[model samples]
Every structure is written in structure tokens, then in C-alpha cells.
Target chain A: MNYLFDLNAFLPGVIAGVAGLIALLIDSYKNDHDGIYGLTVVSLIAALGLSIIDMFGPVGEAWSGMITYGGVSAFGNTVVLLGALFCVLISREYLKAIEHEFGEVYAMVLIATSGMLALASANNLIMIFVGLETMSICLYVLAGLIKEHKIGAEAALKYFLLGAFSTGFLLYGMALLYGATGSLSIPEIAQNASSNLLFIAGAGLLLVGFFFKVSAVPFHMWTPDVYQGTPTTLTAYMATASKSATFVALILIVSKMLPAETAEWSEVLEVIAIITMILGNIIALVQDNIKRMLAYSSIAHAGYLLVGLAAGTPEGYSAVLFYLLAYTIMNVGAFGIVAYYERQQGLDFTDVNNYAGLGFKRPIMGVMLSIFLFSLAGIPPLVGFFGKYLVFAAAINADMIALAVIGVLASAASVYYYLRPMVYMYFREPHKDVPFVQAGITFKGTLIVLTILTIYFGVAFGGLHDLLASYYSGDWVTHLTGN
Target chain B: MISIDWYLALSAILFCIGIVGVLIRKNAIVIFMCVELMLNAVNLSLVSFSSHYGNVDGQILVFFSLAIAAAEAVVGLAIIIAIFRNNFSVDITQINLLRW
Candidate 1:
């Protein structure tokens, strides 16, 4: 247990944190939004590049086993950084349109991204708690970015109250786990994993906390409100990046900390996945608000990811990683388009009926939104379809045929809701003459990049899937599980 | 000497009370306090566990949790105040402008 200062292992998070502080200092002194924004984007891109490089580097624990770097953690960091980059890229135009382009927003986003980075690689319960709270507190403020808007205020309050409440459960669970295992480190907990009452109770509470963060069913009441009320671009950030980071942490817990001999936890996950899928899709079917609908859709996507977790195999875990990357790209694109429309009229522009004839009005955005929605619906030749395919394939391979069948059916049901906006955009006549909203070159460029990635990854998902799967195979498995 | 079980039991009871308060309370401030209580309860348990194990990790975790709770309270109160200024009320039941 040599406590070496492994700067390389923590560099991505360090870059973002230092950049956030600099952004904050700049904001306090000068109030320069553009400079702050540029700084944020450059720092995030550098962090993303470093994380990608780390994925191919040697897998090891660092900071005296409080953090793990390379392999899966690096992949998680890359996904989170990618989500943050896209959100920040598109946020400038949207925030300016809303007349609230504060430099502080950029600082908060960077800080939150750094917290997510910490969470992704967190090997200790203390790191997880601190990382999760840092991210949540910033998000609470971001949710209420417009304090004057009643809905925004309401969203922040609800998010804060619920988020804090969940933190209590999470902390208590961590305490119990520490007591049961006599250690706060994840690998140590795994080595001492047991099916005792305290251990099971702690695991259940931890699951509740993760489920709330991920917005799974029953714990999902906060999603629609928070997503709808938050500024659209930051909503995209919250929905994709934060969820990816938490899911990565949950994956670590499920794979490492839980006793493999117990079928109880898997059964519990299967049930939650079933309910999250059915309810999320069914409720989304009737939503008129595009942001709210995407909220429910995100919940449904979480269910599909949970299906992979329930499969309880290395294949299932890697499938989850692949699905997360695919999910991040398509979701940010979907929400990015929503932000585009949202900033145009400011409030009430997000309703699906308002999208009528919008396809013809702005053909490029219309086409890009279509690509993202289709990908989300798991259509062929898009990354989302491959993501769904890999997850269900992993489930089937693990002999969870019932779970796979239910997942396929739920996703098939999801296609209807995902296509609702497209139907209104292309097929229906415009009830009101809404003018086309002009988007900046960078905003359009980001969407275009996302669209190409969606299609390109769909067609060539094999290589990425193999790469992710390799992270969970052979020596990497022993390294990750600390065997 | 009080066994560690006594501390764990007391902590569990306090946590349950806090959860109940959060679930039933309407005033946003009270709910926030209830959350703080829940956190304090966890802190108690962590401290007891640290002493029981004769290691500093659990105590260190308690410190982090305490710092996090204070940060959370600051944000939560600011949010509650912001919502109050808009709606002129801190009652959770009345803050329903974005319902499903």
C-alpha cells in the first residue's frame, strides 16, 4: 500500500478543477463570459484527450487505492468528458439567447465535470460520497440557474431536497458497509463481501441512492420536473454526463462490492429494470413537453442499462459501457436540438405540437434531430441500435432470456414516443407561423459531429465494443476486482 | 461500557426519525433540517464504527460527510430562499408550478 503521488492517474480531474477555479476568479474580477467559455472548452477537450489516452494505458490503482485509473475508469471519464464538452459547446448560444450567459455557469459546469471524473475513478466510499455531493450541489444551483422562473426555482428545491435525502441514505449505507467490512475501500469490501443482514441492508440502501441519481422508476419523480425546468443545454449536461458517471460508479459497486453468490441482488435489479422500462415508456407516450418526454425516455434508457447490470457478467458490464457512450452521444444531440428550439421563443417552445412544420423551417436541425431520435429509438445503422443490441445480447448470453425479452419489448414500445416529435415536425401542418431560429456555426458543427458519430459508430460498433470488452477480460479483470 | 450496538441502534433510530420528518414535513426549511439530521445520524454511526475498528478511515469519512452536509445545507437553504422569493412561500405543497 505505497501511497505514491500518481499525478497521471488524476490529471484529467485536476485540469478541470484548476480550470474551474480560474474561471471563477475571472468571473469575479472581469465577468467575461466568452473568455471563461473558451477556457472551459479547451480544458475539457484536454481532459477528454487525456482520459482517452488513459484507456489504452496500463490498469492500476493510485492514491493508495482510493482511485483506480486506466481501463474502465478511463473509459467512464472519457464518456463524461465527452458529454460535458458537447453540452458546453452548445450552451453558449442557448445561454446567450436566454440572456443569462453568466461566466459562473461555465465554472460550475467544469467543477461538476471534475467531480464526475473523481466519481468515475473513485475506489473508496469516501471519494464516491465527496464526488457525488460536489456534482449534486453544483447541479442543484444549475437547475435553479434562473431563480426568477418559478418552475426553475421549484426544480432546484425539489432536486436539492430529494438529492440531499438520497445522500443520507447513501452515507448511511457507506457507514454500514464500512462497519461490515472494516474498510472504506471498494476492493476491501469485495474481499470481505458477505450475505449478512447488515451487508444486504447496506447494499439495498446504496442501490436506492444510485437508483435515485439515475432516475429509475419509483425514485424517478424528480426527473421530469428537473429536466423540464432546467435551462435546456444544462439539462442535457445533467441528463447525460451525470447519469453516465453515476452509472459507472454503480457498475463498480455491483461488479466489485456485492457478493457474487447471492442471486438476491440480481433479482432485485431485474425487477427494477422491468418497472423502470414499462413505466418510463408508458408515461413518456403522452408527454407534450419535449424536455419532459426526453426525461422519461432517459429513465427508460436507464432501465436498459440496468438490464445489462442484472445479467451479472463481464460481457454485460462492457455492454453497459458501450451503451453509455452511445447513450451520451445520442441524448446530448437530442437535448441539444431541444435547447436550440427552446432558446428561440423562450418557454413554451418545447411542446411537441409547436414543432409542426419545423422540419421544413430548419431542415438541417430537423434532419439532425431526426437522426438523434431515430438512434434513440434503436433504429438500424445508428449507434443506439447497436447499443441496444449489445446489451440484450449480453443479457441473452448470460441466460437472462426473460430480462432480454422484456428489454426488447420495452425498447420497441419506446420507438413510438421517440418518433412523436418527428411525426409532428414532418407530417402535421403548422398551426402557428413560427419563424426559423438561427443557430451559430459552432452549435451546428457540434450537432453535425454528433450526428456523424451516431451513424459512424452504429455501422462500426464492433471495434469499440471489442475494445470495451477487453477492459473486463483477462488480467484487467483481476486488476479491477483486486484479486 | 456501552457496546457499539447501542450506538448503531441509536443512530438507526435517529435516521428513521429524520426520514419520517422529511417524508411528512411541508416546510422546506424543516425538511432541510430533517436531511441534516439524517446526515448527523450517519455521522454518529461512522464515528462509532471508527472507534470500534480502531482505525481512522471511518472518522475521516465522517469529516468528509460533515463538510458535504454543510455545503449541502448552504445550497439547499439558498434554493429554498430563492423559491420563497418567487412563490412567497416555503411550503412544499404550494411550490407546484411544474407538475406532471
Candidate 2:
């Protein structure tokens, strides 16, 4: 492989950084944050356009194979950017309501997004480390951006400590991998697998790090606190886009670099997937706080995504992509509603009981949130159902009958907790007036678009699956052959 | 007469100590420092590998990791200060405002 610095592969990330810098430079003199906010959104849309355009172009190598384009990585970046776009949409109003509407939010979000874009397409282990750190540091600051809140401050500290520790494990794993293989590129490392205990241990440690980032079982201690501690809008962004990017990087490595040891990884993924699903759902059942509940639900959803990974087939890979697309929309919408409610009542108004008779009092919030909840529960005629269906099908296709059965049982158990909010919203008598702020066009637009997408993908799921198939044949397959 | 294995072994030991510090330490800043220690150990190992293989990639990667570690420390300290402002302490136990 030759080393050449190609700018095309870095275009999306570059544009994002440029946008962030523009926001910061203008923010100091603009007096009001309106200009900064407008510029930030415009640049985000521009980056989104670049990602879409790159999808159709021929796959290319950039930075001497440190990053790849026009395949799963490209599609993954597109999804991450779109998720960030929705986050910005909902965030504009939430920040304003909380009196934290500053240029830093826009700049930090863009910086974190560029990092995610880098991580999504990274081709080398070194690039992955840099990307992860860039994304995580921004997230730590974003989580604690509301410094006046004790919980926000506390949450940031815990997340910073735990996240850095996990990153240590990741760096050590990369070092061991380099020691074992004498290379940093995924393709080169794959070709040089030595089947030594050292290599196995390195890979295992790497999985531990990845699992921590994606909030898998046993390594998920910080997730609930971090999710509940961050301001609702930032939490929404973290739970969806950041988690998806981490999984994309994980899937890329598991599929691209570890095909030689798929058997070894499949066993590990299978066990973790089952435990993650069961434990996440079971624990969610006991949480009274809505944010905490959704945190565990997000973990369970990660488990379902892992089932697609454990299948270890092309079909499974596409299923993971499709599930991520569906899951992002629904999760963002769910968290948007949480933020809206938290803003209306108080920052600490997170108890499910507070939502009693909320459906009758505030029909719009109730209906929209119910739609998100039902989608999360994997109910029919919603994107989450289709996402779950595809992953379960992939598991069964791989002859993993037990895994599929367990996935089904876990989904069944999850319905209770998922409906807990709905029960308080509709079935119970009104405890207090559940008036919500409904003035921001950005907030309303985000809900409207996400609701349409949730139902649109749910009903016309075939269109996406077909498009994914074409993409698989057109770009990813060619890139693999070229490699 | 130190071979590459000696460097690897020494780095590995330092890495383990860092991990223990992160797990066992209660002071937020100390744990944060331990994380930096772990990252430095990795840098040491990477440098050793680069020299043994006579490739510039690992050395280049060490530079990237060093920069990232510094960036991380800046962010970590900022967050610790924010926590300290809110609670007047950086002890992990004292910062427990979120539980589920």
C-alpha cells in the first residue's frame, strides 16, 4: 500500500471543523447567538450533503489508507451526520428554554460530530484512537455544559473518569496488536493474524473497550448516570449518534479485520448479546426515572444490534446498518420528548409518575411520545419493529435458533417497561397539569420529521432494504475486491 | 542489553499499575492522572515497536496519542473544576447526585 494524503475522504470532517470554527469566530462579535446557530445548522446540512454525494461516487482511499470511503463506512458517516442534524434541531429550543443557549453548544456539537465522522470511516487503529478521543472529550464538556446543575457536573466527572479508563484499555489493546502484527492498518493486520495467545488477548481487550463505549452489559456502569446527568438534548445526541458511531467502528473491525477469528468472536458476541438484552430490560423495569429507563432500553437495543453482528454474514451486516438507521430516528424522537417535558416541568422532573394523565392534559406530547415509545417497544407499523424483524431474521438465517428465541423473549419482557410511561400518561388520573412549551418551530419540526420517518420506514421498510442491497453490490463489494 | 521484550515488559507493568490506580483511586484528579499514565505506557510500547521494526508509523502514532492525551487532560480537568465548583470537592463519593 502506498501512502498518499487524499483530501476527498476528509471533506466531511473538514467541513464540520470549518463550521465549528466559523461559529466560534462569529460568536464573539455577533452579540446574539442567532447568527452562530444559523451558521452551525447550515454547515451541518452542507456536511450531510457531502456524505450523500460521496455515497454515489466511486470508493476511494485517503490519507494512505488511514480512512476508507464509499462503503459501509460512508453510509455509516451519513447516518451519524443525519442523527446529529436531528439533535441540533431539537437542541436549539431546549437550550434556549434552559438559558444555556450559547455558541459553545453549537461548536462543541459540530466538533464532536466531525470526530464521529472520522471514527466511522477510520481505516487504521491509530486513526480510531484519535477519533475516539476527539469525540469523547467534546462529549465530556457537552455533558457538563450546564455547570450550574450539580447533577450535570457530577455526571461529567464520572463519565470522564470511566470513559478515559476504558480508552486506556483500548490504547493498550492497539499497542499489543501492533506488537503482535507489526502493522496498524486493518487489512494488513487481518492478513498477518498469527493465532498467538498475545493476539487473542489483544483482541479480547479491544472488545472490552468497544463494549464499554457501546454500553454493553457488565461494562455499562456509567451509561445510566451519564445519560441522566447530561442535559436532555445532549443526552439525546449521545444516546443515538455517538452510540451508533461506536458500533459502526466495532462492526467494521469485527467484519473486516477478524474474519479469521469469527468463530471466537461470535461466541463472545452471542453471550454478551443475550445477557445485555435480558439484563437491560430486566433492570429497566425497576427504574422510576424516564431518562434512566430509556438508558437501559438503549442498552437492550444495543443488544438487538449485536445479534445482527453475531450473525457474522453479509445479511447480518446490512441488518445492523438498517437497524441503526431505524433506531436513530426513534431514539432521538424519544429523547426529544423527554427533554421537552423536562424543560416544561423542571430539570429534575424525571419521575414517570409525574406523567400521570399527561396524555389528556397535553395531547400532543402524549401522542408523540407514545409513538416513540411504541416504536421503541418494537410494535407493528413502526421502524423499530422492522429493525427488530431484520435482526431476528438474520440470527435465524445463521441457524442461531437459540439466539433468536432469546431475543424474542427479551423483547417480550421489554414491553412492560416501555409501556410504563404510556400507562402513567393515559390510564392514571391527572396529578398535575402537564403543560409543555410549544413555541419553538425547531422543536416541533424535529418531532414532525422524526414521526414521519418512524412510520415511513415502518411501512415502506422494503425500499430501504432494497437500497441497502444495491449499495452492498455497488460500492462495498467493489471496495472489498479492490482491497 | 535491553531487548524489545524488556521494554514491552516494563511498559506492561506500568500499564497494569495505571489500570489499578484508575480502579482503586477515589480522588477524581488522581484517577484522571492514572488514565494519562496508561496512555503513556502505550506510547512507550509503541515507541519500542517502532524502533524494533524500523518503521515510522508507530512513532507517528505516538505523537498523535500524545496530543490526544493532552487534549483529554484539558477536558478532564475542566470537568473536574466544574464539579468542584458545584460541590466544593472532587471526591467521587461526594459527587453522587445521580442514581437509578
Candidate 3:
């Protein structure tokens, strides 16, 4: 039981963690906002680089098998770090505009990023639980950052209560699985996996916990409220980075721990996916508030990712990973623009009708917003469409053609809502004058990078898709078992 | 000399009570307490299983769960206080500013 202190395996999380502590120290002593911001950006970029390096490096366990490095974990870390980087870049402007700029925000973001990194690479249930709690607690506080605001308070309270409630189910599920299989290590659990009733129940509860965190339907009631009430930029972090981390962990659970021989789990996931896709898209169609609309859209996106998981093939899993990267890029872009709009002084700034003629006022933001929305709708020649294409193609390859068709139809129906705000922005005449705030250079530059990524990945997604697909080519299981 | 089933059944009942309380309770504090009860119920089961299996993993997990629960309680209580200050109530039904 020798423990390995593999620095590369833990470097990304450790960098973020140490930076968070230092940011807090600086906040208390110097209270320099720019200093904290610079620190966050530097550490996140360094970690992002390391994670990319890990993506190309070897894949194996570290720290006595508490976590894995390289390959899938590295890929997941890259997405999470990318999401956090964009969110932090955009947050300073938005927070200052709202007159709530504080040093603690940077610390919390870094700490949460650290937690997400841990969750992404976790090989043991203990690591997963600790990482999740670490992330969830910071998020609960961040949601209520504007403590004086009533909606922010409500959002934080709801998120905390529901998050804690879900943890109980998750822990109980872990306890049961450990009892049934006599192990907590994911690969070992898979080795001893069976179709017994106890194992099935534990797995079901585990799925429930994962489904709740990912905001799947029937467990998604908290999403819109929380997303709408939290500060727009932080909501982007929650929507993209946190969801990517959880989905990656879920992929590991489904591929490694769940019994492969049984079709029952995949069947259950398929039903949930269909329901999630239809219900999420239908509900999103009616939301007038832009933030609420994106909230429902995120749930719908989760449904599409679940389709890949339900396919239960390596191809399906790889598609899920690729879709996660595409999703992180476009969602952060959408929310970035939303935060930009939110900074303008108007009570109804988030209302879709208020966006009329905004396309004429700020041509760049208007166009970027349109691109993000179009990508979200899975339109052709955009990354979002390719993401949908890969997931559905994987489903079809796995003989789940009906699931793929339903997914296509649901996304097609979704085109209406995604376009509604674009219509307001471009087609309609200005009704109310919401003064335009000048966005910082960094914010604009980040959006430009994201916009480029959306179009570039749309056209040239093949190589990235192939790289992700190679991670799951079956040898990693042997690495996990230490063979 | 008691069988493990008795302990498991008791733990299950406690867990169900916590779930029901969370669903039915209106007070945020009460709901938070219910969530803690659920965690403790799981802790109890973990302890029983640890003894049954002669391994310390379940007990170690219980300790971690306790620490996590404590952290959650601190944050949850702070949030509850913030909400209370804003609205003068911890009743979840009254906190519907962002409803769809």
C-alpha cells in the first residue's frame, strides 16, 4: 500500500488550491482586486497548459489509486479550466458594473476550480465525494455573493438545500455499493460488479445523485431558479465547468463501475434521456428571461449528452467527451454575452424583449450572441451542430437509432427558442434605451477567442474527436486494474 | 449478537424519515436538520458494515462524511441567516423571487 506522490497527477488541482489560499491572504492584507484577478488568470492558464500536456501523456493511476492522470482526466481538467478561465475573465467587469466587486470572488472561483479538477480525476469514491462537496460548498457561497439581494439569497439557499439533500442519497448509495462489493475503488467495484439487487439499488441511487447534479429532468427544478438568480458570469461557471466535471465522472462510473453485461441500466438511461430532451426543450421554449432560457437549454444539453452515455459504447463515450468540450466553449460564450448585457442599468435587462435593436447598437456582441445561440441550437457549420452530430452518430452506431431520431427532433424544435433572442436583437426596433456599457478589452478578447473556437471546431472537429476517441480504446481498464 | 439486517433496517427507516421530512418541512432550518439526519443514517449503516466486514474504510468514510456535513451546516446556516435577514422569514415558500 505504498502511496505515490506523483506531482504531475495532482499539479493542476494543487496549483489552483494554493493560488486560492494566496488570493485569500492577499484579499485580507492588500485587498487588491487586480492583483487577485491576475493571480487567478495566471494559475488557471498554467493548470490549463499542464492538463493539455497530460492529455497527450500516459494514462494511469496515482496517489495510491485515489485518482488518475492523463487521458480522460486530463481532457476533463482542460475543459473545466477553460470554462473557469473564461468565467473569471468576464466576471470582473460584470461584478464591477453591479458594484459588487470583491476579492473573495476570485478566491472562491479558484477553490471551486480546484474542486472540479479533483472531481474530474478522482478514481476513488472518497475523492469524488470530497471533491464534490468542496465544489458544492464554494458554489453555495458564491451564489449568495450579493447577500443583500433577495433573489441571490433565495438562489443560494435553494442550491445549498438541494445540493446537501442529494449528497445524502449519493453517500448512502456509496455505502450500499461498498457493502455489496466490499470495495470503494471504482475499477475494483467494476471487477466485483454483479446484477444482485443490492448492487442494482446502489447503482440506481448513484445515478440519481449524478442526474441531480447534472440537472437532468425530474431532478432539475433547482436549475433555472439558481441560474437566474446567481450573477450571470458565475452562472456560466456553474453551467459549464461544474457540469463538465460531473459528466466526466459519470462517464467513468458508467464505463468502469456499472456492470457491462446488463442492458437494464442503459435502457433506464435511454428513457431518462428521451424524457429529459423533450421536457427540457419544451419548457425552454416559453421562458422570456434570457438567463432562465439558458438554464433550461443547459438541461436540454445534458439530455443530449446522456444519449451518448445511454448508447453504452466506447464511441458513445468519446462523443460525450467531445460534446462536453464543445458545450463548455459555447455555453461560456453565451453566458459571457448575457453578463455583458446584464451590466447595463435596467431592471428588465435580462428580458428578451429588451434586446430589441441591440444588434445595431453593439454589432460585435450582437453577432457573437447570435453565433453562440445558433451553436446552442445545433445549427450547421458550428461546433454545436458537430457535437450533436457525433453524439447521434454514436447512438446510431450503437443501434439506438430511435434515440438519435428523437434527439434530432427535439434539437430541431429547440431552434425556435434559441433564435427568439436573436430575433429580438436583430429584427425588431428598439423599444427601451438601455445604455451600453463599454466592455473591457480582456472580456472582448475572450469572447473573440470563444467565437473563433465555435466556428473553428465546427469545421475542424475531426482531429479533436479522434483524440478523445482514442482515450477509450480499451487499454485504460488494464491500467486501472494495475495489470 | 444481533444480525446486520436489524441495523440496516433501522438505518433505512431513519433515512426515509429524513427524506420525508425534507419534502414535507417548510422551515429551512428543519429541512437542513433533516438532511443531516439522512447523512447520519448513512453513517450508522457505514459503521455497521465496517464492523461486519472488519475493515476501516466505512468508518473512515463516516468521518469524512461528518466533516463534510459540518462544512455544509456552516454554509447552509449562513445562507439561511442571510435569507432570514432579507425576508424576515426562513420559510421556503415565501422565498420565491425567482420562480418560473
Model 2 clash pairs are none
lDDT of 3 by residue, A120-192 (tens): 9999988899999899999999999888989999999999999999999999999999888888899888888
Q: Candidate 2, which segments miss by more than 4 Å at Cα?
A: A1-5, A29-31, A346-348, A474-483
What does the lDDT come to for candidate 2? 0.87
As a whole number from 0 to 100, the lDDT of residue A166 in candidate 1 is 95
Using DockQ as the measure, which candidate wins?
Answer: 1
TM-score of each: 0.98, 0.96, 0.98
| Per-residue accuracy of model 2 over A253-290 as CA lDDT, tens digit each | 99778754423789899999999999999999999999
Give lDDT tens digits, candidate 1, residues B1-100.
Answer: 9999999999999999999999999999999999999999999999999999999999999889888888887888899889889988899999887877
C-alpha-based local distance difference test score of model 3: 0.92
Docking class of 2: high
The digit string of per-residue lDDT tens for model 1 on A1-483 reads 443458778999999999999999999999788899999999999999999999999888998888999999999999999999999999999999999889989999999999999999999999999999999999999999989989899999999999999999999999989888899999889888888888888888888999999999999999999998899999999999999999999999898888666437888988999999999999999998989999999999999999999988899899999999999999999999988888776336788988888899889899999999999999999999999998999889988899999999989999998888999899999887755578999999999999999999999887888889888889746654654
Ten residues in a row with the worst lDDT in model 2 chain A? Answer: A1-10
lDDT of 2 by residue, B1-100 (tens): 6899999999999999999998898899898888899999989999999999898888988999889888888888888888888888888877767776
lDDT of each: 0.92, 0.87, 0.92
lDDT of model 2 at residue A62? 82
Poorest stretch of ten by lDDT in candidate 1 chain B? B91-100
